[model samples]
Target: MEEEYTLDDPTLLLQAASDFGHHPGVHSDASAKAFLHRFPLPVIINGCKNREVAKGFFMVRGWGKQKGSFSEVGCCVQTEDNRGFGFGEYFLEESRSSREMVMEETGKEFGFWEDLWWGDQPLGTQYPRLFRVVVDKNISISSVLGPSRPFSWNLNFRRNLSDSEIEDLEGLMRSLDDLYLSPSVPDARLWPLSSSGLFSVKSFFLALSQSSGSPQNFPSKFVWNSQVPFKVKSFVWLVAHKKVNTNDMLQVRRPYKALSPDICILCMKHGESADHLFLHCSLTIGLWHRLFQLAKMDWVPPRSIYDMMSIKFKGFDNSKRGIVLWQVANIALIRVVWWERNARIFEDKARNSEFLWDSIVFLASLWAFCSKAFKGIPLNVIQLDWIAVCTP
Candidate 1:
């Protein structure tokens, strides 16, 4: 393999797509260009020029290394820029309906304007300027327009002029008359770098990404699987990815350790951490026991949230559906435990283990019944089954 590759190189890009888990035969020239266009040009050009630096930067941001794995790096860039690859634009139908529904309720302009320029229009104030131009009346004008000060300065004053000086100024303004008091409307055809008609490389890439309308990142089967409620799945994703601010995490991140409580709010026996609060705390252990009994399985809680989420119930009742139930139950336990911990700390209230377990049972049943994964299963049936399993 070459040490570097460019977007212009289709074969290498196709290989990169394959490395990113895109099927080999599915990638065509058009598709590859579509994918490559989703990234900033520097991300393509400069990244191709310096492979190690690009790879290192991406790895530090939680992306896995692959030959063509810059897709995720592009996602990180999009996230940092707060300009998703038109996820908002791609779902226009959904957004339009939502926007219309809100309009129906409020009966006013219901959406924000993206390009609204605040304050005065500056239309009349806009004008072209001429500055220290050494023009010789004797010679033909080489170029009348040169670097200039603001038009305000041009209008304000002029020195006592020789007849030739008056002629020169008149010639200069008359030569460039079309530019005087021109409305500075934004150009729609070109990138908004300057009036020089050049591409703003950054804006060009951003516009390219928006025009392609590809997803900011690949679909995550792990997060979007049918086993859990959408809200529960989102919560687990945040926890497993270490995105939430727990006491332990806050202490490590911030210089002031005094800001975060040192002890676990649930147990008050050990330092608080996501793993400890959700999985290992004595208060959470009893809840876990009830969860295991509900599944009728023996499970040693994993040391981390990631592993706990990936745990599959292997008891006698372990069917595909049964596995989903336990997984949903496990994630629900995390959510409830976290909620209870916050309640104790913030609200000065707490629930007992039995109450927590009952919440989990109701939550798990509701999620399963409502989700497409368990569409064939009735709500009452799921509720009864949840109760029967946990009744030991």
Candidate 2:
């Protein structure tokens, strides 16, 4: 006997507007204004308000602005299109988490003195605790210094400074004596990833992608073939990276499941891997041989999909169009084999190697017809003599 019960709706897992509206840290007009108040340099520099400051001096946000009046400086003041000074949208999308942004701002404040060093020797490393006294009191260099030279220090420490602390502070003052604080130009945060030092979403994304330990030997040219359909190209990319859900991949993905017979479905001899399934299997070999025969070329099969995609086939006589046709055929063969394997497993259907070769030629011909080079040419002519039509 089995119990009969209806499963809870899957949509119940998703949050509703009423529920998400109450979630903390949700970006809103008021919250965006608050965030901008914490970092006001962007707001002021973008024609929001006029303020007097030293040229090339970093303007810390909330310096003289009243509390809770971020809008006064046009921080989150919305335009007619509801885009508030552009900072609100940037804060919501481009900027990191609020906590991270706050920590970055705090670090910049504490490390302000280090940036003033114009000498070859690192001042911050030599006198790390030079600004520690003022940092403890949440004091900024701008707050302490007088408007005119000789600048006066108004640092207030939590407790009486020790002899070593006093020595470090004196050294810091001597270091700052030669540094000039500009009175007109506001210090802007430069993006280090790009040459222009301007923040861009593309640069940020590229930085993240590079930092994520991506494979060095990615088959970019092979996987991104413009002749094939986007879906086929994506499938080829997965196969090239050995990320396709072959039997071995299935085993890894569902480790707890009792998936047995992890062998190449096409040959049923060796273990199923991206290399074996698409490149080394007997059925796959036959398809490759057929492709090579149709192209009227002598070739040796590569070890893996990556190797296959990486190698440039010779005998094309430096013909760019011929190379493109060869590439399209290779990609189509891979797609056709995978399709047949899936059909056999899921639909209990099978196709012979010759039939699969025909399918590959048909698929490749269809993609070729889509190209301007093959336009106005009959489909049967292209399919029958792909190499002849593409050759110079």
Backbone Cα, N, C clashes tallied per candidate: 1, 8
Which stretches of model 1 miss by more than 4 angstroms? 1-222, 229-231, 387-392
Over the stretch 1-392, how does candidate 2's per-residue lDDT look in tens digits?
A: 22221223211211232234335767333343443344423332222222222111112321222211111122322223232222322332233321111112212132233332234323444666655654443344455565446877766675688899899888768877875555443332333455654444456667666764666656687678548888888888888788999888888889898667777789989998999988899999988887777666898987778899888776333566676677788898899889988998889898899899888888888887877767688889887876678766
| Model 2 lDDT on a 0 to 1 scale | 0.58
- The lowest-lDDT stretch of 10 consecutive residues in candidate 1 is 98-107
lDDT of residue 368 for candidate 1 = 67
Candidate 1 lDDT by residue in tens digits, 134-165: 22211111122222323321232235656765
The candidate that achieves the highest TM-score relative to the unseen native structure: 2
Clashing pairs in 1: 16-68
